[model samples]
Target: MGNPVQRPLPDIEDPLYQAHFQGLKDQQLRVQQCDACGQLQWPPRDLCKQCHGDRFHWPVMPDQAVVYTYSVVYRAPHPWFKEHLPYAIVVAELENGLRLLGNAFGADVEKIQCGVRVKAHFQHDEDSGVCFLRWVPTTS
Candidate 1:
């Protein structure tokens, strides 16, 4: 059978963050930034976290980051992720001033190291209509 460990992705319906989810579906990573300070914010907020400014805009990501920390899941506590055991759950520090949390594929647990370069990819769930952000090692 197809990957049994696959799980439904998020189908966020709220208009405030619909565009954020759509960006992932389009294979373009985006995050909200303060128009004033240019600080990148995660989870796409309506107002800047730093200055509480309501002038926020979505900016495309450069897709370049380095792993800051990670955990190798040898066993998933839930049935949905069992097949993907031993996956690398990584927190990547983006160059544009953000740390994104996602799964890292195509790398072994022993090979995972802080400062490893990575780029973004997407995984979609047809049933639930959710898109997930995944990462792959960057050659550069």
Candidate 2:
């Protein structure tokens, strides 16, 4: 892990998602929602999957979610994650009934379970200058 890129930065491949990154950059969690049918979606597509409409909106996500499913990665796929061996990649269901995926942020790696309740934590990376989201265990 010798100077092998300390962290991953946001990908600007699609302009539609720039608002998402910008939302995160400002410490607000945003998700894709339909302006037509009010359906929440992910991966930031051009059209709403439910209503088949092109009107999309990114609403600030709530602070809580339940772990839908998760997997621990022992072997660092990229060198940047080498220091964080056995980290968890989690998919959580939002209060609005949509699923989002991110690294389990502040929770103990050992106590991770399928139904664990977590609070969303947003932090700005000094290296990448980007705000990223992670999930931490919460009692309420």
Q: lDDT scores for all predictions? A: 0.78, 0.80
TM-score top scorer: 2
Q: Which digits, one per residue and each the tens of the lDDT, describe model 1 over residues 60-99? A: 8877788888887887877877767778888888986588
* Clashing pairs for predicted structure model 2, backbone only: none
RMSD of each: 2.9, 2.1
Model 1 — which ten-residue stretch has the worst lDDT?
2-11
TM-score of each: 0.82, 0.87
In model 1, state the lDDT of residue 136: 75
